[model samples]
Target: MALELDGFAVLHRIGANRAAFEGISSEVAKVARSLLVKLLKDKRTGVDGVRAVRAALGAEPFALVVDGLTDAEIKSIAKRLDKHNPVLIDGDAATVRKLVGALADGSTEPASRPRAASRGNAKAPKSKKEPTAPKTIARVSFKSAGATRGR
Candidate 1:
């Protein structure tokens, strides 16, 4: 599916119910905006943005963000950035929506904290697989290079 993170121009591309997409996008944006606010704090608001973002997207997503991004995706996005103008840089809503739904529905559970190492016990509890949101790429083009003349 063609995912449009900025402006949602191709929202219909996902084939999900329109209402559902709207709702999901709203929730995703809520979590993202809160995070941005926290990361770029305004003194007048005096809000702890990170905590607020965590509460909105839940602990798992927050932890994922805290854990940081992969070097590969970062490099890819950086390379793409050189070619395109960045209007908005936020989490991919479709991906984030799926994550939120998984979290809400309990289909995907967050990883458990590691147990303290013991000398007698060498084996550790199996860690639940960490959930991931799709990396927000830097280059998102609205139009193709070739275009028809005005009618």
Candidate 2:
């Protein structure tokens, strides 16, 4: 009898195949697959949440199946990981450990605080000086200055 596997199962198999091609041990690949499945199954961290994890695993010197994770995404992932919030899955200590270990060398570092622009600090600061009344000018009549309506 043939066993039927779902889309995600197929994807995991593909990932395992790729890992084998890249010389990654089946055990590490299995751990990565399980971690990915856990993350995907979680309600909070869906497809978007998996992005950082995928990027970190697929980064240079590892180069797993998933690639093309941008620097911004990496930075955002690092930032999230740095927060150390227990409420979120990414912030969970165990998940983080798995993620770091899956990176092949645990070289992925948590990103520092984001830049001012990222933190929404781009708005100009409000002026401290009180508003002054508008300067008033004497009205000048256009007719007196030889300015006519028609040339």
Model 2 Cα RMSD, Å?
Answer: 13.1
Cα lDDT, all candidates:
0.45, 0.49
**Backbone clashes in each candidate structure, one number apiece?**
1, 0
lDDT for each residue of candidate 1 in 97-143, tens digit (9 for 90 to 100): 34333333345443344466677757777999999998998996858
Which one wins on lDDT?
A: 2
Each prediction's Cα RMSD? 30.8, 13.1
Off by over 4 Å in 2: 1-5, 12-67, 84-151
The TM-score measured for candidate 2 stands at 0.24
TM-score of each: 0.21, 0.24
